[model samples]
Structures are given as structure tokens and as C-alpha cells.
Target: MAADTTEWKIKKLIQDLKDQYSKTVRNNPDTVAQIESAVRILSFLVAGRFENGEILSELIYSASNLLVFLNDSVFKAASKYVSKVVNVTKEKIKRWLTVLEYTEVFLEMAAKKKWGTKGAWIVITIIQIMKTALRFYVLVKLDGGIGSTPAIQPVDREILKTAEDEHDNLEDAWDEEAAYSAQEKTFTLQSSGRQIRTLQAAEPGMRTWGVPESGTQSPQNSVLNRKRKMLNQPASKLTKQRKWAEGLHIARPMAHLISMYISGLDSWKPFLLACGMDVTSMYLMGDTKDLNAKEKAELKRRNMMLLYYLMRSPFYDKYTKMRFIAIFRFIAQYVPLSGFIIRPLLEYLPTWQRMYFYVWTL
Candidate 1:
């Protein structure tokens, strides 16, 4: 009886997806390709085989293609129901773009190293699955009832449980990274070819803030030398002072020793870049600004240091991770594109209720 019920549910899900795909195809022939791609992704998920490059490639392409379509239509619909989902608008598509960009870079790196087909598939599968899972969660929520009680033979709690678990893991990872970053005083710097450069620590109006002079030096020295000199400060004091001074330092390639110790900073760099902000600059300019000249860069060196860690902090704890997901979920729920636009039609709902409805419809 249980087996029959489970089989029935799976069949129903597949049928619903096919129906939706057919409807989408009829209304927008241009989107048929994306719908097909989504179908392929679901197929891979159902099969539980991660080694197929052809399938993975198709999944990535379909995901990338649907980003634009989803962003324009479905995402808008979701937003109507969940407005504060993510701070960034259109994050469903943004997340897709993030995965696409990372996948391209990963593939290039894999190709350069002459990674075996299996190896390439392994890497791509991880990224593709992670991306798809996120999209699936949002969709399930958008459709309503990935969480709704099980009236007709409850869905696999494990699927939702695993997602919640992954979400928790990500949060915990973020928190752990944040804690480590705080104590480690991590800073991110840009690497040019072999040289890593960071902001100089010279006081405003003083020359020599992080620029290398005309002396040839080892690559390590080029980066290490950029750090503010202690100027004969004693050893015991050097350790104490460096800790205090780290936050004030800007744009300097993070110390090799420090960077090596704090692995989280490495991954956080891409995430920061995605948000269009430089980690080092934000660290140095407590409150980042575009100043022409003479503007005292609001240098809250210590605060900047703390903020770096805070940004990297893990969403490990269950509640903490849920909070993060809830944020995105809220935003996904609120958009004009997804559901009925009744703000003008029904003005009686309270402000919060109206906002809630708007997000839910999206």
C-alpha cells in the first residue's frame, strides 16, 4: 500500500510538470527550450545518477536559459507573494547567473588541468545540484505546499529535511567562518598576475600608501612588504600591535600566514565580488564611499575587521540558517509578475497583510 502511494505521488508530480511545460510551450514557444531543460533537470534528480556530463551540461544550459525567462515572469509572480525574499531584487535569476559564472570558470579550470571526464562531471554535478536544489526549494515554496501538511500521503520529509539540513550547514559554515575571521582579522586583496596588492596604511596626505617602489623583489616580498612596517617594534609587542592594527590596514594582500590559516576568506571573495563590492576596500573604509579627494575615509579599522568576519559568519545554527532562507523566501513571494495584482482592487488588507499577499502571489 505504501509503495503504491509513493509511486502514485511521483507519477502525479511528473504529470503536473509535463502539463505545466506543455502550457508554457503553448503560450511562449521561445520558452519551450527552457521548459525542456527544466524537465531534464528533474529527470536527473529523479534518476540519482550524477556522472552524466551530457545531462549535467543540459541542466546548466537550461538553468542559465531559464534565468531570463524566470526572472521576467515567474520570479515576478513569486515576488507578489514574498517581497523581502532577498535584499537584491530578482535573486532567483541572480542566483542562476552566479552558478553559471562559477560553472564556466570551473569548467575552464578543469579543462586546463586536463581533468578526466569523471572529474569534470564530479565538479559540475556538485555545483549543478546545489543550484538546482535552491531553485527547486523556491519553486516548491512558490507553488505552496512543499511545507503544507500531508493530507494525501505526505511527501518525503527527507527531501525537505535535507534541504533544511543543507541550509543549516551553510549557515553554520558562515557563522564558523565569521568567528574565525573575527579573531584571525582576515582581509581580502586583489592578485595581479603573480603580484598581490592591497591598500597602503600611510595616514591621509602622507605618501607611500601601499605602492611598491622600483626595487625588484621576490613575489612573496612584493606582497609582504606592502604591509605597514613596524619600524623596530619589539617581538612581543609586534604580535599584540599587529592584531590591533589589522583592521586599519587596507588593500594589502592579506598576510600569507593569515590567509593560509583562514580558508573561509578564499571562498567569500567570490561571493563578495558577486555583490559588486571589494572585500579589502570595505574593510578599510568602514563605511565605503566614493570620495574625490580630501574626504577623510571613515576608517573604522576595528569595526571593518569585525564586519569582514560577520559577513563570512556561518548560517550553521538551525534558526540562523532559516532566517537567511526566510529572507530570500520572503522576497521570492512578493512580485507583480507571479500572482493577482489586487493592491488596487482590495485596499482593506492591513499594510503587513497586503505586503504578505503581494509577496505570496509573486
Candidate 2:
């Protein structure tokens, strides 16, 4: 895995590249710098440095393919399967909420461009978006599954074929020891060598379970006894229930707070207006014709409304609240001194005593 800071730097670089690429593509259709930046970013992404790299790459590639299909009027108008495929693709893509969604949306516009006119520029933008999204996705997946012990799977020959297809230079890189030195660290033993070996154990019939083999209990019986002893520990169902109840209570209030804040008349209008720029940036390559003043104004108005409602959406209301409360609970649980302070207040104590404690702390 890449260092957290290195991953972040890569993401930042990709984002900057995309921002510049978008501006350049819009201003100068003849400029080829965007394509170079995009290809570099895509190469990094396809190199698959991070843990969730494969999943991220697959989703990005699928989304890019779908976007290309969507933009091509010939494909869209030709078949019922195309429309069905697009809907299915959207649903599948929605499973990933963070960077993937943003990348998918970005690609949606690029896919909308006319086939012959600056389509390559749009494809480059798609590549840049995928790179940025993949870095963030990898970060999130690693953080979430940090402590998990992933079960090993049987090696698939198809992996090598897929890599070869994705990158023209991969075949040569596989031969060069220096090129694969870093990759060797990431590859599991199960996925690497042709030969597999494991130590053989004694037959099951030789291992008696319930009865003693000679004078003492059998090895299998001893193992069972130890497992029984381990299982006879106290369980805390009440404590678990209390924690869950508190989390649910906190979440409801947090959702209302977020909804109220986001939907408020004060700052929401400006936020919506600001998001229009982002929407415009993403969809700049979508239409074949240059967006005239009227088209631009209309797009801004429609998209601002879309952004405002999206932010204030019921889905976001609950989601935003859940995320906030989750963080709050994580802090409350993991922060050492805060638990000491909060525990007394959380307990079934008198209101006056709580007030007095708060006053003392202050």
C-alpha cells in the first residue's frame, strides 16, 4: 500500500490536472496537453498501487464504457438494450457513494460529446476523474477494512490476461524484475507460485474425540475441552443494546440538524450557485455545440435547482445525519478523556447534579 500522504498527493495532483484539462479543453480544442496529463493519470490508475485498486479500476472502466455508449447517438438510438444497459450500469455504479459517483457523473458528460469533435479531450478528462476517484476509493477501503484479515482465494489465470489487455507495456514489465519488485510485495503467495504445498496431518480415525486413547484423554478431546472453556465467558447484551439505542437517538437529532442547516434559506442559495460551476465543469464537453449565453444561463438555473434539492434531499438528510453521528460516536468512544467527562452525564443522574458538574468543568 502507498503511504496515506502519498495517496493524498496523487489525488491532489489528479484533481489539479483535471481542473486544468477541463479549462484547456474548453478554451483550445487544438491543445494536446490535456491528453498527456490524462494518459499519465490513467497509467498510474491502471498500475493498481492500492488495495481497492482492482475494484476501482473495474468500476471506472465500466462507467467510461457506458458513458461512451450513452454519448454515441447511433448506439443509444439503435437498441432497447442500450437504454436498459445504461440504467443497470447506473444502479451498479450507485453502490459506491463517494468518489466513484463523482467520477461517473464526470464521465457522463464526456460520453455525451460528439464522436469526431474533441472526443479525445473528453476521454482524457474521464481518465483524470478515474485516477482521482480511485485514489480516494482506495483510501476509504483501506481505512474501513484496516483490521480485517481477508481470506485467501484460488489464483485465477485471467488476472494476468486482464493486465496484459489493459496496458501495452505490462507484458515487458512482467519480465523485468525491477519493474515487478514493488508488485511482488502486494502479491500473495497463493496468487504467485505455480506449485502449492502444505504439511500433512494424522488421519481423523487415529484422533479419538470423546474417549481416551490410552490412559489420558485424546488430543482431539483436549482441544474440545479448551474450546469449551473459551466459550464459557460473560456476554454483555444489555450494554450492547444501550449503546445501539443511544446511537439511534443521536442519529435522529443529527439528521434533523443537518437537514435544517442545508435547507435553510440563508446559505443554501449561495451554495447552490457555487455548485453550478462544478456541474458546468463536469458537463462542459457534453453537448456538441458550444453553450451560448442563453444555453449557459438555462443550464445554470436548472443545475442550481438540481444541486439545491439534491443537498436538501431526504436521502442526504438522513445520510448526512448518520455520518455526523457516526463520527461523533467514534470520537466519544475512542477519545480517552471525553468518556470520563461524558459517562457521569450519560448515567441516570439528577439534572441538578449534571448541571453542577457542567458548571464545575466550565
TM-score top scorer: 1
Q: Write the per-residue lDDT of candidate 1 for residues 1-362, one digit (tens) a residue.
A: 99999999999999999668545543453454466457656643532245544335434644544443443333223222222343233344445545444344335334424676445445544544444444344333332111100101111111211233544675566455444422133234446333322333222354432433332343333333332122111112112232223222311212321332355423444333322223443333433243211122123332343333322323122224456445545554686443343332222222212121111110
Superposed model 1: Cα runs more than 4 Å off: 1-40, 43-279, 288-362
- Could you tell me which 10 consecutive residues in candidate 1 have the lowest summed lDDT? 145-154
Alpha-carbon shift of residue 178 in model 1 (angstroms): 51
* TM-score versus the correct structure, for each prediction: 0.21, 0.15
Q: Which residue ranges in model 2 land beyond 4 Å of their true spot?
A: 1-100, 103-258, 261-362
lDDT (CA) for every model shown? 0.35, 0.36
lDDT by residue (tens digit), candidate 2, 1-362: 46998999999999998666544443432233344345445633652456545334444654544333222322223222222333333323323323333344233333433353245335534443443343334323322110000111111112212222333464344334333333332323566543322122222445322211123343444554454333222212223333333223223223333443476524444334434433443343244244343334433444454443333434334455456446556777999888664553333223212121111110
Per-residue lDDT, model 1, residue 292, is 18
